[model samples]
Target: MYEKELEAILPRCFEMYDFMAEHVEQLQHLEAMPELKLRMAFQSGILSFEHGLSSLKLIADGFTSSGFALMRPQYESLLCGFWLMYADTEAWFNKLSTAGKVSPDEIKKLETPLIGVMLKDLEKSNAPAHILRQLNDFRGINNSAFNSFTHSGLAALVSNGVGYEPKVIYDSLRNCNAVAAINMQMLSILTGYEEAMEPVRKMHHHFVDCLPIIHG
Candidate 1:
């Protein structure tokens, strides 16, 4: 059953994987100032995209809950990376604080100068409208669903049965592809890799074409 579903989407998955691998390699060749926040965010996005591919492969192998659990963080890495691209240094430190990478004592010193500012507050002031819209879309469409799996909620348990459903596998692949497309687009913009544009657009169209719609 899993094999059948995997065989059906294998071609599309391979295409997306190849495209992402090529761009990831290309990204390594581009030079950006070491001090630039966008560069770090772009790198993080790339890493997340790679991990997301691994999760998708697990889904193909019938580890559906595990794959779904990985999706939220993958989405976060992309969202945070893109958000940080336009944020200031203070926002950068704030992010680290939010992630608990910074100690409370250290965050205290950092926050002294940035007393009331929060990452959410910076969104409107720093990020572009389109970026904000993308973040909102992810929150609405994927975030909640992904969270249910990540947190071991009822949705995750309900889908952990023995059989593999083709629609389930296809939807998982589509979600992964969508994230890859967004990650590539963000990297291209930040790294000035205009060559990625055509491939990313093609990938996006593939996702749109393959999406399943429910008629009520």
Candidate 2:
């Protein structure tokens, strides 16, 4: 794997994690909302952000394939959060609330839309246009890679088998950072404190080098 090569990038990756961690900590206390939908939306975004940070740790330690496997969940959580905000009428949230006390099998029976359905639903729900555009672009570019990583396809086999370059690790880290930024921004929105997001914007621009947008 990239055991030796990882050293060259670990410091920057760690810094990115710390920067995001700070934002997460700040957002957590600020997202106090009694509204059920907003609370759930904030929680989902936090989950996505956690996945990004966890993936960074795994990738930094040379577990690139495992790290990548986390990306799809990260993406899905963020998507679901938005879908909750716009597409849902508290139905799914209610189902989830009750499912918490139900058996695992019963919980599995909960009606949740697949990714395609969610996307279509979101479009009609007036989901943020900027987010929709970014999501479409991100998925169009990375759908296959996301599947490969999560499903242990050829891409995962290759990364785990022969290993990859340090730059690949850097790119992966940056990609995770991109999702983290999006999640943090979404959390900021939930906070209803425009000033809370000022730091988020600053953090994003300050570390924009790690975002995929920089590459494009």
Candidate 3:
């Protein structure tokens, strides 16, 4: 039963996975030193997207909870990476400058800014209100919901012992697609990968048409 269901979803999952890998490859070619922190964040997000793809494969193979659990960190990496890019460019660079000699500790410290702090910084920036609202929705709703799956919450428990359902698999695919699309978009913008924009835009449009509502 689950095998048949898995067979049905594999095509679409593979397609999305291919697109994500291509985007990550493009990101790899980017010169990361100028905006090192932002670029590293984008790279981390891309890596997480790859992990999500692996998890999607697991879900397709019927390891539902295991796959769903991976989504939380995957989504966090995307959002946190974008927040680092969006919040304060000057301040990020300033922090790096003040650190004097570049060390692993300094790099790790730069990446340690809390999402809450990033959001607050973003809110105070000159960015438009709609973008802020969208990010808030992502953090409050989508991220919170994804976290539930990892925490052994009702979402994780409810599907246990239930036989295979196509809806569950489809939902997982949609989520993986959405996260990958978002990560690609952020990486393109942050890395100045102009060539990545067309595919990113296409993926964004497809996601808007088919997936659950996730602002930003």
Candidate 4:
């Protein structure tokens, strides 16, 4: 049922793969951030790029649910990465110390602020105003669908157990790339270096074809 769609979309998918690969290559030599906590958060957010790219590949192969499944889990980490940076860095570590060291199970028990609250704190932290504002507005609009995708909710469960439409997958890939572009910009912010940041500032302008239509 999906062969023709795959034929049409596969080339675009490969182009995105190459773009992300180039990004991975581009980010390879970044020096660690001065503080360990900030460095960890930065790395966690960086992870979203590869994760998003992988899900794009899965979607291109006609695995819609699997691709949808990955969207939120990693993206949440990206959000949390920001939270750790601005919202609750010391409190989190203090909690971690109660466990004598980092324990995965204990970490899970720790409370994370909701997305809205985190964004508020990020804004207060003086994160880039434009990015912070867009993140807030975008979450307001799409959080439900994103949450559904992560938790196997109705949106991830399509009718008749069939693959998603090719256009849907194509559009999904574009949106994912848009998020990746944001991720790139965030990474550049982390670097605090113009050389690492210059190209990222023009990512969308250069690669608009494979990215979603974004204004701002």
- Model 1 residue 150 lDDT score: 90
Question: Please, what is the whole-model Cα lDDT of each candidate in the order they appear?
Answer: 0.66, 0.78, 0.67, 0.68
The per-residue C-alpha lDDT of model 1 at residue 182 equals 73
Model 4 spans > 4 angstroms off? 1-10, 101-106, 159-162
Candidate 3 lDDT tens digits, 5-113: 4466577667767866776787678744366667667777776777778777777676877887887677667667766666676766777676767777667765546
Q: Could you tell me how far off, in angstroms, the CA of residue 61 lies in candidate 1 after the best superposition?
A: 1.3
Off by over 4 Å in 2: 1-10, 94-104, 214-216
Instruction: Tell me the TM-score of model 4.
Output: 0.81
RMSD of each: 5.4, 3.2, 4.5, 3.3
lDDT of 4 by residue, 60-166 (tens): 66677888677665566667777776665677677756775657776675666667777777877857677676667657656887777777778777621764666
Model 3 alpha-carbon miss at residue 3, Å:
12
Ranking by lDDT: 2, 4, 3, 1
TM-scores for candidates 1 onward, in order: 0.74, 0.85, 0.72, 0.81
Clashing pairs in 1: none
| Pairs in clash, predicted candidate 2 | none
Q: Where does the lowest 10-residue lDDT sum fall in candidate 1? A: 110-119
Q: Lowest lDDT 10-mer window, candidate 3?
A: 207-216
Clashing pairs in 4: none
